[model samples]
Target: MLIIFSIPWLVWRLLKTDYFAPLVVVQIVMGIVLGPGVLGHWFPAYYEFVFTPTVVHSLNGIAWWSVMLFVMIAGVELDLGKAWQHRRESGITAGLALGAPLLLGCGAAAVLLGFDGWMGPKAQTWQFVVGIGMACAVTALPILILLMEKLDILRQPLGQRILRYASLDDIAIWGVLALILMDWSRIGKQLAFLIAFVVLGLAFRRLMAWLDEADRWYVAPIWLALCGLGADWAGLHFMVGAFLAGAIMDGHWFNQEKLDLLRHHVLLVMMPVFFLSTGLRTNWAVGGTEVFAAAALLLVASVAGKLIGVRIAARVLHWAPGEASIIGWLLQTKALIMIIFANILLDKQVITSEAFTALLLMAVASTMLTVPMVEPQMRRSRALAGSAGQST
Candidate 1:
């Protein structure tokens, strides 16, 4: 844990490229470096000493709860009201943004099926394909917010529009994840759980409303844990339950500033452990060349499909020049959400370690590309608008 916190700061201080590679990105990279594949190879004894079975298990527990809290916060923060107000535009853009990359990624997944190490033992061909496709389509809303804040555009119209589009896609991403994780043998229990959840959700909301603000905060984690247990009992993952816990509750119930601070603190205190654990899952048993090659293929599909889809939406909506390009690049930034999505897929045995590694690399590369690509386009657009204003 000490290593996890310190490495990112060292990288941030030394690298000095926070715009392109922020502390979160550095943490992720450090995770890979500290993982079994790299560090274990270099110093097997030291690696074993540091990450003994007990230590790894403890880390996994931390990672699980950390991600659950993070995802719950994400669900709570979703501005569904805003998206509904601009339903027409948001739907069109979100649909195309999700669909195009999904199709492209499906193609890539189809090709990967010809290989030996990409598919998990328990996954059906269709499940694996759709899982990969959805991973490609996801936009890391939390990371996007962080980046937009850094860029000083978190309150801007463009940022808000992007958030709307990402929010809609976030809903679709999790819904598809639930589908992929459905266990037919447990269908009855799953159905029962859903029914019970809705009934209980209403009761929970009323209880929360009746509670004082101080008490509500104290009770939130208990609710979070119960929801997680119920969902896992029904064969859906706990993360799904965590999301539902937050989604069913009203964001306005809590103070917005407090909620934001909780998210920031979680990222600060817990998320690095999750990143390191995710990195430890990376395996190169299929060979580094093969992994890198697959990563490249997925990266191309993710980037090209996103841009093409956004361009189509821009044409349809008659957005001004350069809007689509910037939106596309921002939308393609996939780090936290994609990693979490991929982690779930791996947990459910939908994708192999090799495939997970490839997806991880693609996410890191795509996220790193976002700020550098968007900044120049943003500058050009602002300059053009300024010139037009002066001429007028």
Candidate 2:
């Protein structure tokens, strides 16, 4: 446990990877480095000794709950009301932002289908294509907020617009996941779960409303656990349930400072375990060259499609020069959320370990590119604004 936490943190600080790769990104990369394909292959005996079945099992438990809590917090941070207020703009941007990449990513998946080891044993062609497509379209909303705050734009007008766009896309991403996970045999159970959720959700809201703020904090996790178990039992997966658990609650109910702290602490203390676990699942049996090639293909599709989509929106909406570039790059940030999305697909056997590894690489590359790409465009925008102000 200490090794898992300390190694990534030490590497992050010592290497000063934060100029492009933040601590979260570093942790994810370290996880991949520590996984079977890399570390285990290099030193099989040591790897086995360190990550024994019992040890791995214990770590898996921690990873699951850590990710569940992080995802739930992401759900709480979503502000659909704000998205609705700027519905026209948000809708158009979100639709295009999600659509173009999904279409292109499906194309990429289709190509991979021509080859072996890309699709999971259990996945139908459509499920594999659509699941991979949606992974390309996801924006890590929590990470976006963090990055924007780092850029000193989180509370700015442009930041708010980006948030609104991401919020809408986040909804679409999860809806598509639920669609992909739909099972005809379990349809009845799924429907029952949804029906129960509606009724229970109403009651949960009422109970939350009546509770003291202090008590509400204590009650939230109990609700989270029940919903997670219910979702998993219904075959939708517990992560979905964790998300739904957070979605129904209003963020305004809690103290903003405390909520932010909660998110930070969760990332700091627990999410490294989740990252490591995610890495351990990556496979290179398809060969490392093949995996890297696949990742490169997905990255191109993801980045290009996002820029194309946003550029179209820019033309349609008459956005300022270079604005689309900034928004497109920022929206393509995909570290945690895409990893989570891929994990679910892997858990359901919709994608093979090779595919998951490729997607993981694509996500890391996408996130690392974000801040560096955006900073220059932002400087240009600021310069333009300043010159305009001076002339005025």
Candidate 3:
């Protein structure tokens, strides 16, 4: 863990390129380098000693809980009511942002199906296509928040608008994931679980309303565990349940400062283990060229599709000229959520390790590109807006 955390910090400090590649992205890259693909290959005995089966198992447990907490926080943080208040703009932007990349990514997935190492054994053609498509469309809401905070825009009107689009897309991304993961054989249980969850969700909300803030925090984890277990038992996976667990709860129940601190601490302390575990899963058995080629394809599809979609929305909505580019690049940021999405796909045997590696690379590259691409455009826009206001 020390090695995992230290390497990324050292790189970030030495390079001093936090604007281009934040510590999180560096950590992700370090995970890949430290995985069997690099470190394990160069120093087999050290890699084996450090990441023995027992140690890997421990890391997996930490990764699981860490991601669960993170996902739940994402769910709770969603400002659905605000999105609904601006329904038309939010709906149009969110739909275009999500749909365009999804279609392009599906096309890419179809192309990949011609190859040997991309599809999992259990995945149907549609599942693979849709899963990959959703991956391309995903915006890592948590990471988006972190980046916006770093860019000093988290409280700005523009930032809030972007958050609305991302929040809606976040909901759709998980819904699509649930659809992809639907077990036909377990349909009965799944339906029952949904029904029970709705009823229990109402009860849970009431319970939360009745509880004091301190008590609510205390009961939150128990609620998370129960929901997660129930969802997994119904074949939907615990992560889905974790998301649902928080999505139903009102963020207003908790102090905003406290929630933010919890999120920061989770990322600080626990998410590195998750990143390392993610790296450990990376495999290059399908050949590095093929993996990288696939990554490039997906990255292009993700970036281009996002830009095109947002441009279309801007045109229709009559947004100012440079706004689409800024929004598109920002929305294209995907790291933690997309990785988690791909991890679930790999776990369910819907995508091969090769596909997972490609997705991982795509996510890292996409995230790294965001701040650099958006900063200048955002500054220009702000300058233009300021001049217009002064002239007025």
Candidate 4:
């Protein structure tokens, strides 16, 4: 109920600002201060009402819908017309992006092993470690697109190339995570479920098409949202359904403009509550001078890891240095996506509360620090591009 108004307010705010440093950090800092660490002490019951067992369970439901809407808009905004304009290069770039993260993340898990606060306890430690690699391997394309637009590179050749790469990257990450989840070892069962997933996906389209013909666009989100619940019931995690629902809706019939309109509707309306809800989850009491140091370390690691991985991959793929650096800087961006996985781990009891707290702090603080460091270069790049155009 409270989520209804809360998300819209946040969306309104996000619309007015550039996301790099200015937008994401403000939310994280405000979230930290308003978080349970501060608010819990000052008003424990009020905090509880918003983040309580029942409330979070409810927020989980809202978050589930948010995920679907987020992905659906990604699919819709995707220039289906440009699919062939750069298919070969897009494929190679996407492959490089996904493969590097997969190997590096999985390998890096040796140092940060047993860190699946998001993988949950039902899955083994190795699986969680695998999830860690998979988590880092993902590129949140929704956020990436937003960043690209903000940087004003949306029409450049390199921009289009990275956009395609990021889209394909999103698809691969979803598939990899599906493979990395629980009940993974039983090949026969997994195969059956894979087949079933395809069947259900096809059926979802037929059903939605019929409904759309009958003027039922509203039903699409609701139906898709319910499928998330069904996925959870089947132990596949609701996000699996959420992702599948999005990909299913990617066909030609779901009007892109309509979806775009819907995108703002949710973003401006219901999304901020989710952000606030996310803030409410952080515990800032752990703050200290050293905590700041560690926060800085996490921020550096998060950005550096992505920059190095993507930069090397970009060069290998023969991208211009300019494009490579932009991709690096852009991909370095992080969001609540990492925090989501970490909290899942906490809920599954796979990690200690302190570790969960630390990672949550890491995510918020990392995102906060991201903008300040990245913005100057982004502005410079834009300015340079402008000067070069005039000179040429």
Question: In order, how many clashes per candidate?
Answer: 0, 0, 0, 13
TM-score of 3: 0.98
TM-scores of the candidates are 0.98, 0.99, 0.98, 0.77
Per-residue lDDT tens digits for candidate 3, residues 133-168, read 999999999999989998889999889999999999
Which scores higher on TM-score, 2 or 4? Answer: 2
Query: Candidate 2, clashing residue pairs?
Result: none
lDDT of 2 at 257: 94
Q: What ordering of candidates by TM-score runs from best to worst?
A: 2, 3, 1, 4
lDDT comparison, 1 vs 4, better candidate = 1
- Model 3 residue 211 CA deviation (Å) reads 0.7
Off by over 4 Å in 2: none
Least accurate stretch of 10 residues (summed lDDT) in model 1?
244-253
Instruction: List the global CA lDDT of all models.
Output: 0.93, 0.94, 0.94, 0.59
> How accurate locally is residue 294 in candidate 4, as Cα lDDT from 0 to 100?
40
Error of 3 at 239 (Å): 0.6
10 residues in a row with least lDDT, candidate 3: 1-10
Candidates ranked, most accurate by lDDT first: 3, 2, 1, 4
lDDT for 229 (candidate 3): 95
| Residue pairs clashing, model 1 | none
Off by over 4 Å in 3: none
**The candidate that achieves the highest TM-score relative to the unseen native structure:** 2
